[model samples]
Target chain A: MDERLLEILEDIQPEVDFETCTTLIDDHYLDSLSIISLVAELEEEFDITIPTVEIIPDNFNSAEKMWEMITRLSEED
Target chain B: MFSIVTYFSVEALLLLLVTALLYACLPQKLRRWVLLLASYIFFYSISGKLLAYLLFSTLSVHHIGLWLADVQNECAAQTKGLARDERKALNAVYQKKQRKIMGFACFIHIGLLVLLKYTPFFSENINTLLKLAGSSFKLQIPKYLIPIGISFYTLQAVAYLFDVYRKKIPADRNLMRLALFMSFFPQLMEGPICRYSDTAVALYDAPKMRYDNFVLGSQRILFGLMKKLVIADRLNLLIQNVYAEPNKYDGFIIALSAVGYTFQLYADFSGTMDLVIGAAQMFGITLPENFKRPFFSATISEFWKRWHITLGTWFKDYIFFPVSMSKPMKKLTTQARKKLGNHYGPLIAGAVSLFCVWICNGLWHGAGWNYIFFGMYHFALILGGNIAEPVVIKITQKLHINRASFPYRCIQIARTFILVCFGELFFRAEGLKSGIKMFCKIFTDFTFASLKSGSLFKCGMDRQDYIIIIVSAILLFVIGILQEKGIQIRNSIAKKNIAVQFAVYYALILFIIIFGAYGAGYVPLDPIYAGF
Candidate 1:
């Protein structure tokens, strides 16, 4: 777990524990636009292009999920 | 002008007969073409010569797009296998040619739009300026009639050029497909602002001629009619009266009228979108969704995101991002941050984007000063929120107050409502001066005691009318709530037993037929967004 990623999560959801908070979409923590904004921020931070089709909730619903998605994208690049 | 008599009594029957005939006679691929033709004829029946302008604009853009694509392909080929200097020279020529073509296309398209929509405003302003200079100049306000779908098609055409430029989609080769994209009759008058990419597939696909599509489309159209006639038009009478003379009303009454206009505009616009999209669906084309439980939005930004989704997206993509991300704007932001510190950069950027969007939005509605003020009013609210967001968050943190607490959320919602009402005051006002007068009257002559005196209903609506408005508004709100919770009303109904489904359908039809503000002494009001 990257400390910078933790810091970003804290900025978005100050009260929630980044490690514990899962199922972001199911919990309704972020709507579609919010998710897009987050993805854009993550792409800028990590220097990776998140494919448009990979932006679905299934791949972005949790910290672990997002990390996995980003890792995959980075690896593909 | 042809004095075409509109017989609402025969409209449904005629539509049904035509729909049936098209379904029975036309082959799969040809039905959509027939529908497209029918749509043009329908628009021509209302707009006459203006329809010819629409056709010309559509055909011109279609041909230009195809030509531009060829030029782009040629440029790509020429750039390949060239030395650096030669490549640069070739690229410059290509760029210059592309720019000329695009500039010419945009000039012609937007020229027609301005001539048709803004001539009166331009003439009046020029005359006023001339008079101020003591010239006493009199200019004839050109009597150019605007086509019914000029604004919509213009936007679509511009979007096509943009799409081609960005290489989001290939320039459409088929003239008929491009024509259908522009003149799809359902969205011709008022739009969800159909995009080339969003609707191209459904528009070009050979029509399936399925019974299911027809039934579903009919049901959707019925739902749209119910929302528009039964709820929106009925509420319009009350809204118009209070807004017409805001001085005679108290703050509460004026506020109520503002709220009423909100509902009326939403229902009228969304209902029309539904009808248009549904009609397109009948021809096996699915137009973009325009509304999605907008009132449930917790923030002003969220409300905009949900309300008029298509138009908002269009503005965001075509106007806001471009202006915000422009080189000059970026340079200014960088300089400002270095001089004024990091805090001011976001604020300045936001203000620039907000101003651009609002000015364009206001002018897009019409040339009236009221519309301009309406645009600025919202611009101020949205910009103010963006500026104050960090300050508010800091204050809450310092006070140890929970930002997402229920009480805080309630306060935010209440403030948003107030801000929205104030903006709507300008939107519904007759002119800029009247908007100011009515706004001042809100505080000067406000009396809450008089609100309960039953004088509010006297504003062109009787007791029964008020009752109907309130009831229908409640119904509208209830349905909106259901939708906000992600309950797909149509799909839910489809999932029900056949008997129950039929019963609900019959009930909806009966409600619309009996309670609708159409037929028998009712003058049908044009869909409000058609003016834009």
Candidate 2:
């Protein structure tokens, strides 16, 4: 799951080093448009529904946070 | 009723003074109530008997907020010990029910807005259709007494309800706090449409106004007045002339009106925001900023992001994000990715969402065809920019051109400014047909004769007015540059000696008094966005 998450991040926004980067939203490395596209990509890859309420910065601000959210949601399934 | 800007009347100033004194003297717990009282007074001044609209909006949203919160709480309690899948199903049912509650509330509030604001426009269009069809019956267009700031406050109320539904902030149970949020006087006329979570705490806290808050707020208000009176109102005469009788002049004058109206709009709207935010600061009630230096934007999308920052964000949160992430758009994104490939696929959803936003943007400005065209104009520009992004990058790379060079960046800004000005032309035109005709004439009747003929001065202003406008505009531009660099002019000045600070403050007042376009012959134009 972690490896696949890294691949998704790389495919969506290749310029950023998702491994170490922590300020995806604050630094505007991920804009609102990019966030939408990223969410769509994540939903397709993981086969899990990510609702709008879960789209806040805390969940997607960094690769680590993204992994945590995915792990929790995948656990629910 | 007080004319705040018409003459910088003493009555309004006295009201502000008295309100400040009342707020300062009141107990901390009651200070928020003082603000609520002041809001009612201000609303009553403009709306008189029509204050019911505001009250109605407040009550409806408040009730809806409580209902949504209660439903969520009940469902949570019921599902706490249930089986996992069963709980999920139960939660889904409650969620659907809550959505209905939120949706119906939004529909009612927004429906009232549409009825009051757009009925005349709809009636007029229907009458035109009847005439075209050779019908004897024609619709009687009924005019409405639209309460001041309905457009702004309605959006604020709607946002508050949504915030409650989303559990962004628990449904604010205090009716008065919610009412104050809906009718905060400073932003009632125009807004940076604030959110409940961001502003409610400070608003309800009602902290005593610090010295810095008062001084900074006054300075900001004065700065806004200077922009409005010294530049925007001064230029209003010539622009009004060109727009009122667009076909009478040549292309140069029409084009000049377009550019002038654009600056006038920026100065007027941003000035109002400065004054609004500044006034709020005086009460230690923070409001969001509505603009950045939009002219510096290199692309249309960038321009929207910078200009009217709050409105754009509101639309993004309420319209764009929801539409883009909707189930249907997800399917569209999937299909587009499979057929059109990754590079252009996601933007299909983005574009459709953007299209809805622009349509709303156009209609939100007013119930006018030209405004719709203005919205579509930007939509086309932004979508075009998006689609051409990679191609432009490839071209720049192939040419080995330095895209970040000063000259190259200037070219981008200038192109974007021109595109913005052309849209504002349509936005400020008398009607859609007038805008189209004026646009056509700009190319066909392009001639240097208007400049040489000395017909420019004949529009309204003399050479002296022109000189004042140019110098003031230069000053504003320099200040904008400093601000863009993140320099706080007020703070820097505050660091100066008392004498220097006093002199600077007095000088700003004197400059505004002498140069402001309000006197025996001149009537200072109202802030343009105030109507919206």
Candidate 3:
């Protein structure tokens, strides 16, 4: 799951080091348009819905945060 | 109707002092009531009978919140012990019901705002259309005594409703808690637009006044006064004259005034926020910061994020994300990504959402073609920038120009500022036609004849006034640079010796007293955002 998520992140923004950098949204690495692409990619890959409420900076700021949210959401589903 | 004119007025200061005193003397539990009553009094003084509008909004929001809470409770009870599939199905049914209720709530709340605020603008446009159609019939345009800060508070109320519906926040059962949040006197006029989860409980708690907070808050308030009195009001003398009659001036004068108007607006609106947030801080409630050195922004999109930040976030959360993430838009995003690749793919859905957000943003400021033009102007710039990004990057790479270099970043900032100033020119013009004429004159009759002849200072601002404005702007720019570097001026000051702190305060007060625009020949721009 982590590898796939990193692959998607790299595919969207090739310049960003998705492993070490955590301020993706905060630093403008992942803007609204990027997030749109990301959410669609994540849902398709993981088969879990990402609601608008969960699209906050904390969830997508890092790969770990995104993984945690995906795992928690999938369990809830 | 009362002596309290604006937050900067002596009368308003007296009201704040008296309220602070009362709040301090009151029991911890009763402190919230004092705040609530003071908020109502403040509203009543400004809007008079229009206070009823605020009361109605508060009560309606309170009731709707409870209703939504009740619906949630019923759903929880019904879904108990159900299997996963059944529970999901039941939740969907309940969600539909909640959506219907949310729709009605918005109708009542947003409906009242539209009817009150936009009726005249809408009717006038309709009448023009009718006249064009060769019809004699006309709609009667009615004037409304719009409650001061209705625009600000209405957004707050709707945000509350949305938060409750999303279950991000449990709907408040306490009326006074919600009321205090909605009508919190400090942020009532021009807001940083506090969220329920962030502010409601803080207002209810009404923490005891601390000495550090008092000093820090007072310092902030004084800084706000410096911005408003020394800069915003002073610039008003030039901006008002130029905007009121753009054709009377050349493009140079018009352009200068546009930049002046932009500064005036920043100082005016952000100054008000400083006062608002500072006042709230004195009571130990930390409202969200609104302005974040917007002039330093590298793009129009970044400018929006930095300036009037709360409003930007509100639209992002409530409008942009929702529209973009809706089922159809989601599907569009998925398909587009495959076809257009990562960058341009989701842009199709994003553009649609951006359009909706901008249109609402334009109308939200006021009902005018110029305001709408301002919105579309920005929309075009942002979308154009996004579309051109790859090409620009490739071109820069080919030219061996490092985008991260200081010179490059400075160029970006400068370009963004010019674009923003142009938008403000349209925003501040008397009408769309006048705005166009003024813009055209900049190119058609471009000359520095006024400066050569020294007539530039003759219109509203004299030589001395110009000198003072330049010095004050330099001061503001230095301060902005420090703030951008993450230096908290107030905290730094607080850590200084008592004498230094006092000197800083006294210097600020003296500056305002010496150069503040008031008394005669100058009308301080009426709280700019208040009209919106």
Q: Which candidate number would show the highest DockQ if scored against the true structure?
A: 3
lDDT of each residue in B235-281, candidate 2, tens digit only: 98788888989878898888887888899999888887888888888
Deviating ranges (above 4 Å) for candidate 3: A2-7, A15-21, B1-3
Question: What's the true lDDT of residue B412 in model 2?
Answer: 98
| B1-532 per-residue lDDT for model 1 (tens digits) | 2222221224533654586577558776786677677667767776887778888988898888887899989998978887756876786798678879888988899888988889999899999999999996699888777788788889999888877865567998888888888887667777888779888767767466566676677778878887788778787777877777777777777767777777778878888777777777676677889898776666787778788888888887777756655556555654554475444553576578778998888999889889888888778877777667679889999999998887987787777767777777788888888778777877777776655787766776668767777787788788877886788788788778889889988998998877888766565656678778
Give the TM-scores of the predictions, in the order they appear.
0.85, 0.96, 0.98
Q: Tens digit of lDDT per residue, candidate 1, span A1-77?
A: 77666676665556667687787777767543344345545766787655444655787677888888888876544
Model 1 stretches with alpha carbons more than 4 Å out: A1-77, B1-13, B82-93, B337-343
- For each candidate, how many residue pairs have backbone atoms clashing (under 3 Å)? 0, 0, 0
Per-residue CA lDDT of candidate 2, range A1-77, in tens?
38888887787678999999989988878876677778887888887778766788888889999988887876553
Residue-level lDDT of model 3, residues A1-77, one tens digit each, is 48999999998999998899889889989988999988988988998888788999999889889999999988665
Candidate 3: chain B TM-score against the reference chain B: 0.99
Ten residues in sequence with the least summed lDDT for candidate 1 chain B = B1-10
**Between which residue pairs do clashes occur in model 1?**
none
| TM-scores of chain A across candidates | 0.85, 0.90, 0.96
What level of docking quality does candidate 3 show? medium
